[model samples]
Structure formats: structure tokens, C-alpha cells
Target: METSSLDQVRAAEFASGGATAYLATASCGLLPRRAVEAVTALAERNATGSRGGAGSFDAVDRARAGFARIAGVDPGRVSTGGSVAVHVALVAASLPAGAEVLAPEGEFSSVVSPFAVRGDLRMRYVPLAGLAEAVRPETALVALSAAQSSDGRVADLDAVRAAAAAHGARTLLDASQSAGWLPLDAGAYDYTVTGAFKFLMCPRGTSFLTVTEEAQETLPVLYAGWLSAEDRWNSTYGPVRRLAADARRYDEPVAFLAYHGAEHALALVAEVGVDALYEHATGLAARFREGLGALGHPAVPGTSAIVAVPGLGAREPELADAGVLVSNRAGNLRAAFHVYNTEADVDRALDVLAR
Candidate 1:
């Protein structure tokens, strides 16, 4: 599909939604109407037992390819799953018993917890700004969110990646908060995981992992099953002695419904392009921040798609009552703008907060 301008995108794909100002996309994005229909149509096919109805696998393949385009990786490097923690666990489990894992302080739990939970792994936390400088020869892995979930602070991925490479340490990037509107190359890291339910704007129950070939060979195949076989259809009833040679070896059994919606959602993202998405979303966030300043509720400083105002978390319910739905996290009122949002939406939210 040819990419559309942000104007065409908002009007065509994101025009209908319930909230007066859906400023909570950082919490969970608004699904495009086509995505909703794709999911619903799959369910209808299942219920009616339509001819050749077992086409759910097609959706999975399409979503995988769509995400590959978004992440700038080959489909073979991509693996499918349902949770960030679960995928991260694979990387964590592969670390040597006493390997050191370096991560940013206040990084999202899924990105850090997997390594932490491994009692033998030494987990060190540093501020996001100092992460690159903190990487050492002893650090076996450097893990982080591409964008901080708490305040929308984007990490310097280039610096971190270079530091990790210099130290011969692998890098794992969690793009759950960044992938949709933040253009990034997943292949740049040793491993990258993203949950589609949030910024990727799909339904719950689908996540993706991309691995470098070296990382794939280093990780174990402890979770292999019928679905992990290179010939899944033929190996469904057997011991599945041979797993897929690529990242698909890490695949969990497919989630039919989630990927059905994801196929459409990821395609829409590709159609809109993340660079355009970044401009459109962050523009609204900047507008919202400017308005918040005028209202004397200066937000956490950043140019990302999410704007969080400290000390205004208590006002979340007040804004919601006034039809401006947003989120409160870590004592900050977080508002995220996406393709659907407009200056009008930003103004409406500011007007509500003005009182």
C-alpha cells in the first residue's frame, strides 16, 4: 500500500472513536476501524464454519511480514508471541549464569525484570542518560526500552548500541513504547521485542521479537513445540525434533484472533509510515504541553508523543469526568497523541484542564 499523508490517515483510519480527547494512547492505542473489522470477520468465519475457514495462519504470516517492514528486518528474524516478558525471558535465560546485565534506572519492568529474575545474573541499573558510559567489559548484555515508558524520554540508541558493541555485549531493545511512531531499525540491536497492544495499536495477546542470527544461535530452544517446527503443519502431531533454524524457533503457539487484527493494524502503520506518525503525534503532544504551560500545569519535558504532567495525576479523574480520557502513571498525568488526534483534541483537553 502507498503511504498516506497524516491528514488522509486521520480522516480515513482514525476518524471514529468514543473519547472526546483520547489522550491515553501511551496506555493503549485506539484500534483503527479496519483492524476491528478484520478481527470481527475472523470470529464470524469461525462461528459460521465457513468453507476454508481455517485461514488464521495467513493473518499471522501477513502480520509478521508487515512488522518486518516496520522494524526493518527480514521475516525470518521475527518471532511471534503474546508478552514482552515472555520473549525477554528467552534472552535472559540464554545469558551465562553469572553474566552482568546493564539497564537504565526506571526502565520498564519487562525490559529489566527478565534479567533481574534470574538470580544468578548481576543486574545493574543506571540513569538512562548515563547508560552508555556505564557499559563495561563485564556487562554481558545491555537492555532498555527505546523510549522510557514513564515520561516519554527517548534513549540514545546509537550511543548505547555502540557502547555494547565496543564491550562485546549484546543489546536488547524493548520497543513497546516507541515502535509505532518512533522509526527504528530492529536489526541494529541483538534482539528487539515489542508488544502490539499499546503503540502498535493491535488487540491484546500479540507481541513480536526480532533476533540477529548470532543471537538466535546463542539462545536455547527450551520452549520448542509443534508450532516451533520449520514444517509446523506436518509436525503438528510429532515430537518435532527439528525446530526452525531462524527466530521462529522461539515462536510460541499462534494467537489467531490477535494476529488477525494485528495484520490490519501493522499494515495501517506501514501505510502511514512511522516518520509521518512521529511528526503528527509529537506535534499534538507539543501543542498539549504548550497549553498545559499556559494552564500553569507544566508537563514533564520531552518532544515525544507522550506528555506527562507531574502533580496533576490527581486530576485524571476530573478530566475524564469532563470527557478527556487520559492516564495516570507514577504520579503523572500522561497524555499520548497518535494519528487520530488533532489540535482540536488537544485544545479540548486543555480547555478541560483549564478549569
Candidate 2:
């Protein structure tokens, strides 16, 4: 597509105000105008209880199907959830008692907290650089985010999978940071989880999990809600029933209205094409890095959309006063880029840092 055509399409999709340096994608993405419209339509339906059951069900199914396509998995393998933390709990609870779960140090707190609280499970943290050497036979599950939440470092999924396989470990990938900006093949891992609010441009409180066929039989369902069963509407009986299949087995009750917004966001992404979006986003990051370098504020090595820079140990508030919105962790300023950001935004950020 021509550059002008692509820019026009992106502008149309971006509904936010004047593009004053939006570097907070790691926290939450700027919702597109169409997504806002979809959300509003859903609200209107819910207001009058006019959201037909069949229509809602179909919308939810299509959202799951859209997530499946984006993750390169079968629609039957995708399950809906409210957030990444919920999915992590599902994964942690599914493991056998006393199983060791291996993950990278500095992983998102959501992934770490659940495993940490499990008395029967052992939690192991390996440095991101040393993951290949850390997998062991006793590790029942090896979970890591495809992109580091702290520094936006992209992991080599193929290598991680190979290492996990060598140790007979099943792998779960948190693709929340990479999904809409990178090509994710669900076949590469046993389970993959992602939140729709970031690069997917959906509203908050929306997420999905996909499980490989090999894991469908082995992984346990921790929180089996009414929606998870084979016949969710069947009110017959004594005890609650387990879901019949993989995706359905891990399902939970969620607002189909929220899912409709997510579906619209995914459809917009599909129209733009993931490969094209990836290239655009990466290019923008590269430009931001270059601008930061010129301002003597270069990004940390291995940075991508999420860039981390050195900051005064406790003086990060200074940057905030300068009109540059960024988050700090352990004396590092982390800035994230997305499709909504532009070269001018990078320049503006550089100007703020320079001041």
C-alpha cells in the first residue's frame, strides 16, 4: 500500500486528540474511533436489555475466532477471559501439585504472584539472558512473556520452546505486549495469553487464552464457571459439569458487549494487516531510539516498542513535570510506542527530555 494511503487509514482508525507524544502503550493503548463506536453501541443495547442472546453469543464467538486467527490457532483453541492475570491463575492452577513452574526474572507481577502464592508449586526465576541454560527436567511448566514487560525485549520463542522441550517442560507464552505488533504462531507454544487493551486497541478488561491440542488434555481447569460447560444453558441437575473441549473447557462468563468492541478492534487490525503494522511500529521505535540518541538519552539495548532509559534513581518526577509521560521502574524510564504514535511525537518527547 502507498504510504499516504496507509497513513490515511491509520489516521481514520486513530480517534484520539492532537498527537502530543503518546508513549504509554505498555500501560494502555489509545482506542480507535471505530472501537469507541462499537463500545457505545454495545452499551446502548445493554441499556435496554435489547442485546439478543443469539446475537451476543455470535459476537463473542467471532471475537474468539478473531483472536484465534491473530494468534495462528484454531478457533476451538481460544478461550476468553477478563485479563492476563486471570489466565495466569488458570495456568497456575492447572499444573499438577508440587510441580515446578519456571519463568524469567522480572516477568509481569500478574504472572509471578499467582505461582508465588501456591504452596504446592515451586517457583523458579531465570534471567532473561540465561533462560536457555535454566530449564530442567523437574520444571513442569516454563512460562515467559514473548516481550518483556519491563524493557520490551523480544524473546526468541523458537529457542525458548526448544529449550523447554529438551527438559520435557510445557511452555506458556504471555503475548500481551507483542500480539498486535508481531506475528504470533500459537503452534509455537503449549499455551498463549494476551490482553486486548494494548496493541489490539480494545478496551480494558478484555483478554484471551489459547491452548495447543497437546495441552488440552493435560491442563486442568481451575475456575470452571457456568459458561465453560458443554451445555451452558442446560439447567438439569446435581453437580456442575466440566467443559467438553479444550477452549470451551477454560471458558468463563464475560460481557459479550465488551467482546464486541474487541472484535471490532481485531477486525481493524486484520484490515491493516499484522505484518504491515509490525513494520510500522518497529520503524517508529527505531526512529524514537535515534531521536533519543541525539538528545543524549539513548534507549537501553534490546529495546523495541517499549524502550527503557536511565533516569535519576528517585528523580523521575522531574521528567513528568517536563510533560513527558512515562513510567519508571528501578530507576529506568520505560516508553512504549504504537501505531498511534508518529515521528513528530518522538521529536516532541526528545525536546521534553532535552529541556
Candidate 3:
């Protein structure tokens, strides 16, 4: 589709959601119509005993390919996981001993806990302002969230990657909140992790990790399961010594049927084009910030799509009762916007705050 035409379609889709304010893309996103249809079709297929054998294989392959395309990586470099946190832990555990990991001070617990618990690993918490100065030759890894979950502050990835390169450190990004709303340059990092449920508009429990070619050779396998083996399901397979070159080396064997819903959701996002979806979301977020300013609830300076506005010291429950749904983070009301939200929704949310 032409760029303008695609933008118009996105705008119309956002407008069709009606007047209910949905400023929560950071927490969850509204599933698109196509995703809903795909989920239903998958559910029906499962009900009719079409889930196994050749059909299931095709379904799984399509899902992997869809994820790889969105991530801007080769299909062989993508792996499915139950959650982004799980994959982050897996990556952390696989790093070499005595590795020093540099991360933000107030990052999500999932990103912090894995590296913190290792006896041989040293964790350094870099202040947001001093991240560039924290990189050192001893640092083996630099892990960070693409966007700060608390206030939607985006990291300067170019600088971060450059610093890590100078220190001979591998970079890993937790892109759970930024993937669907921003253009991801896969060539810039060693590994990128994301969850499908949040911005990808998929069901919960669907997550993925994209690894670079260098990571494939250097990183050790932390959670190698049957599926991660070279010939996991081959009937004639004897003991296999080599792991698959693909990112399938990170996948676990247990399958969650609900993941089909998440896979279908990701496919829809890919069809819509992530760049277009990101533009729509950022535009809506700008409108929402403007509306919030008019209501005397200005967003924190330098905030991105996941904006945080002061609640005038009101409790979070009070804001919810006022007909606005948002998250409370560090004494601020967090608001998010996605492709399915309209300007009218922002106005309505502001109206609630005005009361």
C-alpha cells in the first residue's frame, strides 16, 4: 500500500474504536481485527484436530518468519519464549563467568535480577545521565531496556552501542515496549528481546529473542531443551552433538496453545507495517500530551510514547475512578498511546482529569 493510504487506514482504524480512552499501550495494546480473526481461525483449527503433524509445522514456521521480519533479523536468529524476562535471564546466564554487566539503576526487576544473582558476575547500576561514562574494558555486557518503563524516556542507543563496542562489551536490549512503536535497527545490537503481548498486541505468554551472528558463536546455551537440539523431533535421530545454528537453541519444549493467538497477533502487526504503526502511535501520543497540558497535567519533559503526567498527588485509585485508566509509576500517572487510539480518546481522558 502507498504510504499516505496506509496512514489513512491507520487513522480510520484508530477512530473506529469509539470515545473510550485507551492510554495503556505500555501495559497492553488493543488487538487489531485481523489478529482477532487469525486467533479465531487457529482456535477452530485446534478444535478440529488440525493442530499436529504437517499443519502444525507450517503454522510454527510462519510464526517464526513473521517475528523475524518484524525484528529485522534472519529467521534462523529468532527464538520463541514464554516471556521476555525468561529470555533475558537465559541470555544473562549464558554469558561468560566474571562478566560485568552495566545497566540502568531503576530498570525493571526482570532485567536486574538475573545478573545480580550471579556470584562471579558484577552488576553496575549506571545513572541515566552517566550511562556513557560507565562502560569500561572489564564490562562484558551492556543490557538496557529500549525505553524506560517508568517514564517513557528513550535511551540514546547509538551512543550506548558505541561505548559498548569500545569496551568490547556485547549489547542486549529489552525492546518489549519499543518494538511496535519505534523503528528497530537490528544491526546495532548483539541481542534484542521483546514480549508480544504489550505493543505487539498479542496474547500474554508470547515473547521472542533475536540474536546476532556474533552472539550465536560467543554466547553459551543456558536453557537448552529438546527442541533446541539439532534434530529434536526426528524419529531416526540418535544422540546429536551439535545444536542448531538458528535461534531455536533458546526455545523450550512446552507449547502453550494460547501462543497461537499471540503469533496471529504478531502476524497482523507485520502486515500493518511496524513503521506505519509507530508513526500513528507517536502522533496520537503527541496529541494526548497536548490535551494533558490543557488540563494542567503536563507530561514529564523528554517523555516518549509512554508518557507520565503528575496526578496532583492524588492516589492511583482516585484517577481510575475518575474514568481514566493509566498506570502509576514513581508518583506519576503513566499514559500510553497505540495505533488503535484516537484523538477523541485523549480529549475524553483529559476531560476526566479536568473533573
- Which candidate has the top score in TM-score? 1
Which residue ranges in model 3 land beyond 4 Å of their true spot?
1-19, 44-55, 235-241, 254-256, 310-319
Give candidate 1's TM-score: 0.96
Q: List model 3 lDDT by residue over 1-355, tens digit each.
A: 3556665656643445343566777888777655566567766776787745123545555677777888887889888877777778877877778788999988887777877877779888977667767899998888898888887888888889989999899998988888887877765788888877788887666778888887878666777656677777762255546777688888755444545566677776777788777777777778878877887677876647777776543545665765557787877788887766667667777777777
Screening candidate 2 with a backbone cut-off below 3 angstroms (N, C-alpha, C), the clashing residue pairs are none
Alpha-carbon error at 287 in model 3, in Å? 2.0
Ranking by TM-score: 1, 2, 3
- Native-to-model Cα distance after best TM-score fit, residue 321 in candidate 3, in Å: 3.6
What TM-score does prediction 2 earn? 0.92
The residue ranges of model 1 lying beyond 4 angstroms of the native Cα positions read 1-4, 15-19, 52-55
TM-score of 3: 0.88
Q: After superposition, how far is residue 56 of candidate 1 from its true place, in Å?
A: 2.0
Cα error of candidate 1 at position 346, Å: 0.8
Error of 1 at 312 (Å): 1.4
Ranking by lDDT: 1, 2, 3
